[model samples]
Target: MSPFVIAITLSAAVLHAVWNAIVKTAVDRTTTLGLVAFGHVLPATVMVLLLPLPNAESFFYILLSTVVHFGYFFMLGKAYQHGDLSVVYPIARGIVPALVSLWALILLGEVLPAQAWIGIAVIALGIQLSSWKVLRSGVGKAALGFAVGTGFCISIYSVVDGIGVRLSGNTLSYWAWGAFLHIFIAGFIGLRKRATLAALPLRVWALGIAGGLVSMTAYGLVLYAKNFAPLGAVSALRETSVIFAALIGLVFLREGNWKRRLGAAVLMAMGVALIGTSA
Candidate 1:
């Protein structure tokens, strides 16, 4: 990948970690999640109105992605509920690089060089190492299970959007429509948590909406990069978000051992260097 795409994906990774940290901090995660979806809808609606529709061929991918997002949100909330941000975030995101690579190979016929595959493995190892304490203890089975499920959902949508945006012929339009369709996700969550959402304070609402904006921008960057890089390489690089999450967890959430994360960070940097050169 080009340096520009690398920079863009890394920026997205940071923003992604920021939003998930927001969710992990929220008192009412499910309701906060709904507002985050609302966040997507607010900007997406304006974009959809201003931009021409994405190709019809991309619509199916958009719809399917929306449905998959529902499961993703649910799994994420559950995972956070059952575990710490440090533990849950790493496990949930760490597995996605390999899975997306496999899916890209099978579904999209995209292949990577041996160096790229090795880089992905190194990144995955670094991510898992971020949560070594909890993994060794074998605690939070529910959190681990839900996090794995979330990773599976993420990989599916990553590949789906990778293909969708390529076919749409307009990256921004594809992103806008995909985000706008989150209206369904927002509405469903709102209906289920209507009482909680109604009682939320203004500060929480603002935070949720802000998190939504961050989330949208992060995914938009990833989708845009897909146009320039192979799906597996893009995803492996993006999963570096887990490292960002680890730092956020340690410094902000006060959740993990900085010593362990420092080692993981070094490994992640090495992995990034390998992948960067693979292009």
Candidate 2:
């Protein structure tokens, strides 16, 4: 992993954490997510007009990623319905890196360095530590199931998109097309919640659109980083967002047990240092 790729991935981590925090704190998560999907549509539509179409070979991966993302959104919405950000976010994001790495090695033939694997383990441990209280107290079976499902969806799409972009021969084009495909997801959600979606205030709409943009940019950075680094390593580095979300939950949402959460954040930071140095 080059420093440039690491920087891009870390930047994406911050943005990813911020947008997720927004959705976690929103009054209507599903509706907010729908609007965020709309946000993707706007930029994607524009980029599609400006850029050439992606290679034919990449279409299959793009379509597959879109389907996987639908499952991800569904699982994520359900998880949030039954769990707290501190608990749900960590579990949902924490499991992705290792799964992605394993899949990449088996399917994509991308092997990572030993230090990178250590960093991934450290980050995963830190993420679990951040949510130790909730896990110890016992989370609902539904939330746990949904969160794990969401993590699986994330891993699948991470590998899919990594290969898709690499095959596209034009990173921006693939990103644009991928963003454009979010319209199908937004449309499905919007049709299901037409009444509620229409009733939202301008401020809520603005927030959703803003979050959408942030989320798109965050993932776009990750996709770009994937072109330069091993998929699993990038995925692990991205999971640092869980720590950022924990801090955000503490400061903005006023969640309890700041001491433990801060300690967990420190652990994640150490993992990040290991990644940066090892790279």
Candidate 3:
């Protein structure tokens, strides 16, 4: 990856974690997510009015992405329903890059270098270790297990979006439309739950909505960054959210053991080093 792309992805990592931290803080997760949906839609709705329509090809990818993104939001909400943010967030985001790499190679012939593979493995191992807990757990194991499955589906969507953006060849327009479509789908889900309006303090609304903007900024940067690097590399770097989310959970959420968090950091760092060297 080019320095510019690497920098962009790294910056997105920080931003993604920050907004997720905000979501994690919500007293009512569904309400906060509804506001987040509103935040993304309002901007994209404006963009849709100003921008030209996406070509037929872009539309197909965008449509597919919308489905995946909705699934991502659903799984994410369900993941929070099961366990600590520290445990749920990392496994969901952390394990994905490697899985994405595997899928890319099998389907699209996108291969990572051997070193990057090793790096990804190290990173995944570290994340799994950090998230593990003793048998006596407060949360439902079945729910957490399903949550993991949900997160895995999210990885599928990330891969889908990366490939879709590449095939569409107009990342800016694609993202603009994708944002609007994703919001609509999430809104449908939120309405079904009867949690479509803000029922929170003004501060929470402000933060959650602003978080939607931050999310766009982060994902938008990655869409542009994908132009320079292999999708696998770009995808893996984004998954660095695993480390960032872990730190946020520990410090802000007070979610887990210090030793495991340190281990997670070391693993993520080592993986980054390997991927960087491979690049």
lDDT of 2 by residue, 218-242 (tens): 9999999988877877887887787
lDDT for predicted candidate 1 compared with the true structure:
0.87
Per-model TM values vs. the true structure: 0.94, 0.93, 0.90
Candidate that beats the other on lDDT, 2 or 3, i.e. the better one: 2
Task: Provide the lDDT at 126 for model 3.
Answer: 73
Q: Write the per-residue lDDT of candidate 3 for residues 1-279, one digit (tens) a residue.
A: 777888899899889888878777777776667677767887888888887776666677688777777777777766676666667666666666777777778878987789988998887777667555622553456545655676577667666777777776577777888888757765685677564353456887787789888888888888887767777787778877767888888887887576777577668757755765575
Among all windows of 10 consecutive residues in model 3, the one with the lowest summed lDDT is: 134-143
The root-mean-square deviation over C-alpha atoms between each candidate and the true structure, in angstroms, is: 1.7, 1.8, 2.4
Arrange candidates, best lDDT first: 1, 2, 3
Q: Any idea how many clashes model 3 has?
A: 0
lDDT (Cα, tens digit) per residue for candidate 1, span 1-279: 788999999899899999999999998888889999999999999999999988899999999999999999999999989988877877777778778888999998887678977877887787678666657897677888898999999999999999999999899999999999999989999999988888888999999999999999999999999999988778877877877887888888887567777577657656755665676
Model 1 regions lying over 4 Å from their true place: 131-135, 265-269
Candidate 3 C-alpha error for residue 124, in Å = 3.0
Number of the top candidate by TM-score?
Answer: 1
